[model samples]
Every structure is written in structure tokens, then in C-alpha cells.
Target: MSGNWTEQRIPDQRGRIAIVTGGNTGLGFETARMLAGHGATVVLAVRDVEKGRQAAARITGNTAVQLLDLTSLDSIRTAAADLRAAYPRIDLLINNAGVMYTPKLTTADGFELQFGTNHLGHFALTGLLLESLLPVPGSRVVTVSSTAHRINAAIHFDDLLWQRSYSRSGAYGQSKLANLMFTYELQRRLAYHGSTIAVAAHPGVSNTELARNLPGWMRMIVTGLAPLITQKAAIGALPTLRAATDPSILGGEFYGPDGWGEMRGYPKLVTSSAASHDQKIQQQLWAVSEELTGVTFPVK
Candidate 1:
């Protein structure tokens, strides 16, 4: 509700347990660091064990590492099982891992790289861990989307994998859009159970390693204008951290930067594109995601 909400406003997270995907670097690392610093038992769920350990070593609080390669469903399943075994209750699940603007590529499961890793991977992980969250009052699932969701984005049901052809920007937009849709749909499902909630947030234009896959020309352009347009990853992680820890946050809400064009500033409650709020598409994508990942939520 304040115009200047910062990480310091995060209530003491002394007893909460949080799982942050891709916590080894960039926005994920910053998110994990802040949550851990605030007293939450943070798990850095990364694809690289060594990097994860290094990340955990950097944080000075209750933190641990877990291997989680979003590109592989097997890895997701194993990581979820291990987490369930270790923690009886999960207070937060931050779907902070994702790819962007990559060349046409598929995950190990044959889905488009961006869609699979960004949307489906998180979709499956959340479902697998839903039980651990259900019993925990005040639990939350914070999914990281992007402002890119408004750029030529649509859920292509006819070819969800972009099998025929693909545009790097378009595919990335689709994946980010799916992240918001999944959050809204999941929140609707969670409403019936009345314990946990789903929310979404975006970093705006952050200077993070997520841009490594951009094409040469675009990369050059971005690099040239990076100083004026991009915010540091730490600042960018605020929206997500706020969504995860803000006690006043509600289900299905989206958060992002408060600056011009939402390119950079303090975190605030923001509105996504109209299409992203479409309940019909959100529900349809939920069904397709379940069928594709073979991971179904326990929510009725």
C-alpha cells in the first residue's frame, strides 16, 4: 500500500521455509539472499550443485542447496521428492528460474525451451510440491513473469511447442505470459482449499544473465543502452521478494517496477495485459500443462 515498499518491509520470516529456483545467480540469487537474510530457511534450487553451494556460502543465514534443472522433468521430480522428504511444510515456492530469447530449442521433454523451462517446469514443480504447502497457513507461490508478456504474446494451443517455426522474442513472451496465467489459475484453484495462494511478479528490465541468449544484434543494442534502461538485479528482485513476503498481498495479483514504462523502480502492485487476465485461456493452459507434464495439482 505504501509507495516506497522495500525489502526491509518484509516481515520477519523466522519460521518460514522458501524454495527459490535458479538461486545460483542473477535475480534468483538476490531473492534467495534477501529471504535468507530475513531469517527464512532458504533452499537454492539450482541446476549446478557447485554453483548452488557457492551461492549458499555467500548467504549468511539458514540456507541450503538443491539441484534442480528445469529443462529436465526427471530432475524436477527428484528435486521435488527430496524437498518433500526434507521439509514437512513449504512456506514459499518462488518460481524464479527461466530462459529468455534463445534460439529455437526444445527441452529434454520436447517442449520449446522457453515454454518448458519457464512455464511447464514451474507448473510441474508447483503441483508436485502442492501437498507440502496446503497444510501451511499463509503459504504462497510467487511466480516470476515479465513485461515481455505484452509483446506479441499468445497461447498457441495449435502448436504449443512452436514446432512449425519460432521467433525468439515471441516465444519468450509466450512463456512469460504463461507464467502469469498459471499463477492466476492456480490462485483460483487454491481459493477452494483456503490456505495457500498464488501470486506473480516481474523484474522489469533488469541487468541479469537472463539476456545471455539474445541474438548478437539485439544483444549489442541492449548493451549499448543498458545503463539507462536496466536496473541492478538486486533492485529487480524486489517485486518477487515483496510478492513472496508481503503479508498484505493477495492471490492472483501481479507486482512489478513502479518507474516509467515499468523499466525500473521500487516494487508496486501492477496490472498485466488484458490477455493475461483471461480466465478462459488461463484454464485451458492449465489443462494443457497438466497433460504435458503429467503433474497434476491436488486442488479440486
Candidate 2:
């Protein structure tokens, strides 16, 4: 497909149902808005119920809010149960929620905050909801990764939780890298089932609250270069929107901006790091994630 893909190209979604995590703000919000506007029933699965409701209110059409605290397995289970009861089938599951460059912190489950939330949380959520997606012929699972996945990133099997020492950037990289690996491995698994598909997309550097956790100096540099380096949240959401809606999109394909260095512009299929394509590492991470999250997919 061309790099000029836009939300205008999204086909009618009259009977589709989309669930976007972190849909309360930023790229997730824009994605949810466009999907709902295109006639899909969208659920803003967010950490904060009130904020999600407010976000839903801002969008027209069939939109609802559901509580989903990715940091907590209990919350994921509850939210998935509710969704299963409400909708037997789901057309799109967008793993758009994530934390970046957070301080050394652990989730309720004691895993590193960034890895736990960005990768493992989505991993568990998708597995728990696999049944709902499998029966839907054209269902998709789109996970939002990042360019940072290539920045000296690895799974860090020895210290997956950053227990020995921590660098915010490194942990964030691991999490994002895991996102890509998960999508690739998931696509492979889904191929056997021959129902749903898995794809990944990255929002080119966007001006969003996700950057609030950056170091002081980095934040200052970003602010100074914002005009040239960052795009609006709506623009940043294009890659994900395309990954979710574009009929030509294939399983395991990744999308990102078309600008220089992929910092900004229209969405197009993009390549991830060599490390991200390592099938052995992807399988290992899949096993680790399942063990860590205690949620296994129905697929082999």
C-alpha cells in the first residue's frame, strides 16, 4: 500500500466492534474517535473509569468506557469478563496503552512497570480475549510499539525486571521490543487458527503525555525541537488506524510514519530492528510473558 493512507480511506465499519486500550487520551483517543465515527462500536478501555467516560462523551456514535488497569491482572480479568459477557465477538483489539521512561517501579504483580504494562499487560489481555476474537472472521489484534524498540533494546532475560540496576530508557526499549515480538509470534500462532490476525504499528514521535516521564534534560530538548520532530496525536495515530482498518494490511506487518527517520508524516509499512525479528527470542519472550502474566492463549 501507499504511504498516503488516511482515516478517510477506512471502509464502513457499521457492524464492527473495536476495543482500544488507553483510549482516554493521545493517539488511542484519536483512533477510537475515528473508528467510532466510521460506525464501529468502540470501547475505551482505560485505567481511569472517569477519564474514559469523559473521552467517550467527546466522541460521537456508539462509544463506551470500560475500566482496564493493565498493571493489575485482576483488573484485566474483570474487564475481559465484562467484555465477553457483553460482546461475544470483537473485530479489533488495539493495544494502545503504555508507559514510557518511568522511574524504577513495579506493578501490583511485582514486574517492572514499563515491561509489565506495555507488553505483558497487553499479552495477557489478548490471550484472555482470544476466544472472543477467534470466532470473528476478520478480527485483528494491533499492538502499538515504538521506534525506541531499536535503541539498544533486548529482552534482558537475566534481569527482566531491572532488578539489579535500571535505566529508564533501557527498560522502555525492552517493553517496546517485546511489543513487536509479541505481534510477530501472535501472527504465527493465529495463522494456525486461521481466524484473527496480529499486526503492529508505531506512532511517530507525537506530542503526547506519554513523554511526560522523560528525564528533565530530554524533555527540554524535546520541547525545543517539538515543532520539527513531533506530530499531533491525531497524525501520530494514522499508522495504527491503518494497521487496524486497511484491508490490504497483512498479518505480522508493521507500520509507521513515512517522514525522514520516521519521526513524522503519513503511515506506511515499516521495518523493525533485527533483534525484533529473531524468532528464537520471540518464542522465549512469549514463554516468559505467559509465565509472568499467567494467561495463556487458546492457540498452540
Candidate 3:
């Protein structure tokens, strides 16, 4: 997927249906735009209805927006159900919505805001929409993660709600790590059941609202430094786009930048930390997710 990738080689996406969380802005917007530009019918599953519509209008490709507040389980189920009722199949589902660096806050569901919106909500949505996803054999689900995950080690199961100590970066790391774990677990399950859908992807560095939760001055500094150090949002979207449409992709493979320590570059197949690849932890997290969500995946 390195130098070999060219816009010409990309497949014709006309008539394909795709769903992108947070598709109104940032990397998600770029991803949705690229997919839609290639002719896929994109559903912009955004948190804000008005903003989503505005964003959809701004995009040159075919797209529509629907309400999707990832902070609430009910919201996820309702939106997913509506999508299922409207679309016969989803060719791609990009879990690109996220928050970073914020004072500890809880969602409408009483879970940590970032974890709830970033991990659990997508978890529930994916599970509930198994009907729409599975029938499309080569359909892919790309969960966006950050390089910050490499330094994160604590899943903090005992304090999952962050009832105890709290650190913004730590919590963000855990949520992003969960994205990776969930991807691997889904891949394992699909393989075990011989399902053809492939799941993979992560974003390394890009300027986006996801960092809105960051400390004010820190975000300013990050924005200030991003020009020199950060990849543009379009480049940031490449990994996810590749994972979604690349015919050569394999399940459980992560993609990111190839530049300095993988912080920025065109999307390519990148490896994560060994801990991120641990199957034992993956299984444990999967168990906890099912127990916590009370929604069993339809895949056997």
C-alpha cells in the first residue's frame, strides 16, 4: 500500500453504501469525502444534526447525515436500526469519532465521556448492526486510533468508569487501545466463524477536533507544532481509507504513518506495540465489553 497505491488503482465505489461516525469534520470528514468521491453512498453519522447536514452539503460527493450521539447506548441502537432499515448493506463502517485530553467527565450513560463515545458506543452500534455488516462479505470496519496508544498499558478494568484516579491521556489511551483490541477480537471471531469481512485500521497523527478535549494552551501548542510535525487531515485519512477499500488487506492488520516513529505519512500497513497484539488481553476486554453492554454479538 506504499508507493503502489494510486488514485487510479482504487476501485469504483459507485452504489456502495458506507457509514462514517464523525463524518462531519476532521479525519472522518476527509475519509467520508474520499469514499463518497469515489462514488460510495456515504452516511455521515454525526453527533450534531445541523452540522452534519452542513458538512454533507459542503462535500462534493453524495452524502447524507443522521443523528448519532455516540455517548448514549440508546442513541447508538436507534441510529443503527434506522440505518439498517434504510440501507440493505453497509460496505464500510469507520469508527472515526473520538475525544482527547479532557477533564474527567461522564456521558449521558454515566460512563467516562471519551470511553463511552469512542469505544462502547461504537461497540454497541457494531454489534447491533451485525445484520447490515455481515452480509457484505468484503465489508470492513476501520477503528481510528492514535500513536499515544503505544505508551498506554492500563486497561483499568476495576476502575473502568474511572471512579478512582483519573488522567486524561491515560483514559484516552485506554479508549484507543480498546479500539485495537476490539478490532482484533472481531477479526478473530470472524475468522473462527469463517466470515469474509475484514476489520482493521488506525490513524497516527492529524489535526482534528478530537483534540478539543486537550488542555487549551497544549492544543494551541500542538496546533502550532502540527504544521512541522503533523500530517494533514487528508493524509491522516489515508490509513482508514486504505483499510476500508484495499482489496489486498488482511484481518487484524493495523495501518498508520510511516514517517518519524509513525507520526505522519501516507497510510501504510503499520504495526502496533506487542501489548496491543496480546490475545489474552483482547479476550478479556471482549468478555468485559459483552458483560458491560449486555448485547451479545450475532456472530457465533
Candidate 4:
């Protein structure tokens, strides 16, 4: 497809079911709104029920709210169970929620906060919900990664939890990189079945709450440059929307902004870091994720 893909190009989604994590605000909210407006029954899977409901109300079409705390495994499982019971089949699962530049901290599962919520949480959620997707044709799993993955990122296998030392950017990069690795690995695993596909996307630099934890100096710089460098959540969501709905999009493909530095513009096919395409590393990350989350994909 050309670099002009927009939400207007999104195909009709009348009976499709889509679940978007962190759909209450920012990119996720815009994504859900667009999809719901186009006829899909959208579910806002978020940490806050009231916010999700408010978000749902603002959407024009069919929408629902589901409480999902990505940092908690118990909550993930419960949400998955509830969703399974509510919808026997799903057409789209968009893993769009994430944290950025967070202070040193851990999740309820005792993992680095960024890696835990951004990668592992989505990892486990997808695994548990795979069965519902596997039986449906044209089903898709779209993971939202970031350009940050290209910034001094490594899996840190020796100390996956960053037990040794932690740099906020490094940890955030690791998680984003994991998001890409997970997409590639999942697509490879799903290839034989030919029923579902995994694709990835990045919002570029968008004005969102994800950066609330950035250091003071960095935050000020971002704020000052926001108008020229950053796009709104609607624009930032195009790549993900394209990845989720575009019929031409293939598994393992990535989409992002089409502007300079990929910081803003329309959605277009994009490339990721060479390190992110390392098959060996991808497999290793997959194994480690399965081990960490104790949730295995049904494909393999």
C-alpha cells in the first residue's frame, strides 16, 4: 500500500469484535473510537472501569468496558475468562497500552515495571486469548511497539529483570523491542495454521500520557518541541489501525508514520532494528516469555 493509508480507508467491520488494551485514552481511545464508528463491537480493556465506561460513552457505536490490570496475572486471566465467555470469537486484539521512561519499580509479579506491563502482560493476555482467535478467519493480533526499541535496547538475558542495574530508557527500550520480537515470533508460529496473523506498529512521537514519567529536563524539552515533533493520538493511531485492518498487511510486517525520523505523518510500511529481526533472539525471548508468564500459545 502507499504511504497514504488513513482511517477512512479502514474496511467495513460490521460484525467484527475488537478488544483494545488501554483504550480509555490517547492512541488506544482514538483507535477504539475509529473502529467502533466503523461498525465493530469494541471493548476497552483497561485498568480503570469507570474510565473505560466514560471512554465507551464517548464512542458512537457499540462499546463495552472490561477491567484489566496488565501488571497482574490474576487480573489478566480473569479478564480473559470473562471475554471468552462474552465473545466466543474475536477478530482483533490490539495490544496498545504501555508505559514509558518509568522510575525503577516492579509489577505485582515482581518484574521491571516497563517490561512487565508493556511486554509480559500483553504476552500472557494474547496467549490466554489465542484459542478464541485461532478458529476465526482473518483474525489478527496487532502489537504496538515504538521507535524507542532502536535506542540502546537489548534483552538483558543475564539479568532480565534488570536486577544488576537499571536505566529508565534502557528498560523501556527492552520492553518495546520485546514487543516487536513477540510479533515476529508469534507470526512465525501462526504461519502454519493460516488462520491468524500477528503484525506490529508504532505511533511515532505522539502527545500522550505515556511520557508522564520522563525525567524533568526531558519532559520540558518534549513539551517545548511538542507542536513541531508530535502528532495527536488520532494520527498516532493510524499505523496500528492499518496493521489491524488493512487486508494487504502481512504477518510480521510493521507500520509507522511516514515522516522524517518517523515522528509524524501518515501510516506506511516501516522497518525495525536489525537486532529486532534476530531469529535467535526472537526465539529466546519467546521461550523466556512463556516461562515467565506460564502462558503458552496454542499454536505450538
Q: Candidate 1 clashing pairs?
A: none
lDDT of 4 at 24: 100
- Tens-digit lDDT track of model 4 for 22-108: 999999999999999899999999999999998899999999999999999999999999999999999999999999999999999
- lDDT of candidate 3 at residue 230, scale 0 to 100: 78
Candidate 4 ranges beyond 4 A from true positions: 1-3
Q: TM-score of every model?
A: 0.98, 0.99, 0.95, 0.99
Top of the candidates by lDDT: 4
Q: Write the per-residue lDDT of candidate 1 for residues 1-300, one digit (tens) a residue.
A: 545888788889999999999999999999999999999999999999999999899998999999998999999999999999999899999999999999899999999999999999999999999999999999999999999998786898888899998989989999999999999999999999967999999999999999999889999999999999999999999999999988889999999999999999999999999999899999999999999999989996
How close to the true structure is residue 56 of candidate 1, measured as C-alpha lDDT?
93
Off by over 4 Å in 3: 1-9
Q: Candidate 2 at 64: error in angstroms?
A: 0.8
Cα displacement (Å) at residue 188, model 3: 0.3
Candidate 1 lDDT score at position 73:
96
Q: Candidate 3: which pairs clash?
A: 101-213
Q: In model 4, what lDDT does residue 258 have?
A: 94
Model 1 C-alpha RMSD vs. true structure (Å) is 0.9
lDDT of 3 by residue, 1-300 (tens): 347453445688998889999999998898888888899999999889999998898788889888999988778878988999989788788888888877889888788987887788888888887777777778777788777776566577888878788888888888888888889888888776544454556666677777777787887898888888777788788888888888888988888877787777766788777777889988888888887776679775
Error of 4 at 67 (Å): 0.6
lDDT of each: 0.94, 0.95, 0.81, 0.95
lDDT of 4: 0.95
Tens digit of per-residue lDDT, candidate 2, span 253-293:
99999999999999998999999999999999999999988
Pairs with backbone N, CA or C atoms under 3 Å apart (clashes), candidate 2: none
**Candidate 3, overall lDDT?**
0.81
> What's the true lDDT of residue 110 in model 3?
88
